[model samples]
Target: MAPKEKDDKPIKINKWEGAAVKNALDDAVKEVLTKKFNYVENFALMDGRLVICGIAVGVAMFALVWDYLYPFPQSRPILIFSVTTYFIMMGILTLYTTYKEKGIFAVCIQKDSSKKENVWEASSYLPKYDDKYNLILALIDGKTRQRRETSIKKSVANYIDVNGSVVNELVEAEVTKMHNSLLSERKEK
Candidate 1:
């Protein structure tokens, strides 16, 4: 359970629960680690596709060995084997050409009624968080944007809009690609 606030004073988070808090923190850390693992897995998948393609070609190219081994001897079996391996390898290697990618995204908006200015910041490209997700940052005006995180001054409110499911693959992509995210804050009027 979430720690309850004391009646008369500000809740002292550390004074109450220790193990519970630690467990919560540990869970959160594990969640993030899982995300990172997903990212690496996607990277590895992309890498593996390339490697498979290479191996397929390597197998087919070795078919030429049949000619060398057949000096004056009729190695019909070798020739047929090499040709079959080459065709099968080429067919399998060609499949890598068709592949797709995806990622997750979050949006944050900040606003203050008193001011006319707003900020659009993404979860990615924040300089401190360029990689690990896909971030698209844009400086927007008073007008609305198609899809973006808007922050107005003073409210200090928080809003998160997460898009897409957890992709346990492309963990190491630029944060903006692996996930789409935005953060913005606004002040109270």
Candidate 2:
């Protein structure tokens, strides 16, 4: 007897059901926390802002004291220029920070590369309600690394929910149906 060859076809394992879903969701949340809410980056920006503000304050105070002490006519223009430049720089930094943060949140979802046959990619929008996330899950072909299907569940763990929880139910059912439909469509072709 000849040995059987292994199938190279991608397999879809249900990562979005039972306790597994919790783990997947936790991983997604962790990614968001680590990448989007990065403490080090935040601290650095905040420190920069504080330093700029302090410099502005120090300059203003020095100018006030100097003017009161000596009353130089030329000092006012120099003080104004320095203070205005500091404020403008601070504003630019603030705008850049805001744009950077928004960009992070805008593309929060990332691909999952743990498996070789089928991959589960997950993303979420900013929580609209306290402790509730709007999650989007995609099933990707590991070989092609392309998204085959997607499922959106809004307000996970919502009070008086319509969409239902992310765990132990919704995603698996939806994905399975999609998988079956795809299989059937392929067979027909």
Candidate 3:
């Protein structure tokens, strides 16, 4: 049976029951950690070559529209100024956002002299997030283990205080249960 909270409380939480609570907390923490890693992965995606290309195209279109709608005193000077400014801003944004780059991008070019045809293919540039993902998972596991150990220690101490030497078997059983739970989790992985 779970130990009573005290004279003032109504319900009691035994060691086994406390495991359920800890399991829920563990799941929530794991979800949060996974979500953090997902956010990092999304950030990595945002700095891709495709996004840069899209930004360049968008800025060019905006410049064209601005020039068309409002004619400056000199068309050539205004166009040159806006285009240069846009490219400078794009370069700054790219530097700020894309700090790290991993993996190689391959481009293939094929030319036929007789047919006078050329084909160009480019590989996608995507960041590799496997290391970060694995590190996050390991952190989640470490945090979960730490939380469970502290909770079990507190429960065992309380049980000992309440029942003295008689609760030794219960403590042993609880330890065994914790060991089994960790083993099962490792097996799942």
Candidate 4:
């Protein structure tokens, strides 16, 4: 992916820095690793097991073919064991790659619905503290709107520690206004 155009929006820090706040931020970051984002977490344990089983069967068939060609008494068993072990390892690796591909597949599906313009280039925004922080604030706002029972903003407000509630209130209002505008536009269409 190419670098994204720089955002002109000012980077704003609302909270005080502290060990507790850092830990909370770290935890919140980890939340992105779930199926909601990473997608691999949704894989069933059986998928891995099935891959192992398939490998075993394929290795057995290969061993049989090798034995038929060589017809050696001493080398057959050793060859079979080695082939089985090697194939098992390779099979496990292949299965893991498949599992990872599934996650990417999920991401691709969600990518289409994410944003029409694709202005938020995650690659460019991820490394900068300011961009990442603002992105998190936006995510919290959107998530909080989607699930009213769980206030993502309230949960992390202490960590971000914007001086007063005013900053957060402003963010909420903006999110709501944008959401309402989108709804009204859709209704008009």
Against the reference, the lDDT scores of all candidates come to 0.36, 0.46, 0.38, 0.39
Residues 107-177 of candidate 4: C-alpha lDDT, one tens digit per residue: 11113244431111111012323323322211212222331111122334533435422233334443344
Off by over 4 Å in 4: 1-126, 131-167
Measured with C-alpha atoms, the lDDT of residue 146 in candidate 1 is 38
Best of the two (1, 3) by lDDT: 3
Winner on TM-score between 1 and 4 is 1
Candidate 3 Cα errors over 4 Å, as ranges: 1-55, 70-73, 93-98, 102-189
Candidate 2: clashing pairs of residues: none
Can you rank all candidates by lDDT, best first? 2, 4, 3, 1
Residues 63-176, model 1: lDDT tens digits: 566566665257666667766877776666455434321111222233536464443322221122121222333333444543444221211011111221122222223233
- Across 1-189, the per-residue lDDT of candidate 3 in tens digits comes to 888754323223342333433332233232332332221112343346566766677777877887788776546676787688678868865675455332112111223335432221111121232111111111113222321111132332332333222233343354345444543654566
RMSD of 1: 16.6
Give the candidate number with the greatest lDDT.
2
Would you give me the overall lDDT of model 1?
0.36
TM-score for candidate 3, residues paired by index: 0.26
Query: TM-score for model 1?
Result: 0.30
